[model samples]
Target: MGLRPQLMDSTRSQDQDQNSTQDATALIQQLEQDRAWLLEQIDRGRWQEFRLDLAALERELGQLLQRASEHFSSGSE
Candidate 1:
């Protein structure tokens, strides 16, 4: 017999879970890289530029954390 409906649904759900976890991880990594880049700019004594970059990074980090929280909460439900 062919695969049951429940099995197919479960497989698709697992695929979605994996993809979302990967996306969240990638976003986290990107934010970390942005932070490192900002630190490097600061080390170069670009205070003004660093300030702008830091502000932008802070906003981006907030958004990422919100997304991660939503993802985890939804996954748990």
Candidate 2:
């Protein structure tokens, strides 16, 4: 009985870890796509479009930084 509960808890932990890994991978892919799009816009001499993309990337980066900070702070606590 106790073993069954432990097994379920272990499985849940594994699933949570896997989900976090998938989320990180997706974020990296999104950042790469955004960077490519920004470069293309800049190469085309579309300053306005470039600015928009740059702003978006900056926002994404800022969010990621905040998330990392929060995770680390919580871990320490």
Candidate 3:
């Protein structure tokens, strides 16, 4: 026999939770590294590279927000 429906649903939910937690942790680490890189750039006066990193940071932040929203909605359900 196949897995029970409830068991499958629970497993799926757990997987989502695990993935979401990992994503959030990785995002936080990325942000910290970005912060350090920004400071280093500022000290070195690398304005051009700083601007490039800023653009990349925006993308990372957007992805983080999207993942957080998905996780929040799913967990609340």
Give the alpha-carbon lDDT of every model: 0.74, 0.69, 0.71
List candidate 2 stretches off by more than 4 Å: 48-77
- Itemize residue pairs with steric clashes in candidate 1: none
lDDT of 1 at 1: 41
Report backbone clashes per prediction: 0, 0, 0
For all predicted structures, in order, the TM-scores are: 0.58, 0.57, 0.52
Ranking by lDDT: 1, 3, 2
Candidate 2 Cα deviation (angstroms), residue 77: 27
Error of 3 at 18 (Å): 0.4
* Model 3 TM-score relative to the real fold: 0.52
lDDT (0-100) at residue 30 of candidate 3?
Answer: 77
CA error at residue 10 for candidate 1, angstroms: 1.0
User: Can you write out model 3's per-residue Cα lDDT over 1-77, one digit (the tens) per residue?
Assistant: 36698898999999998897777767767766776776567566677756767767756766875676677567656
Backbone-clash count (model 3):
0
Global CA lDDT computed for model 1: 0.74
Candidate 2, residues 1-77: lDDT per residue as tens digits? Answer: 87999999999998987777667656766766676676677567777746777767766775775676566446444
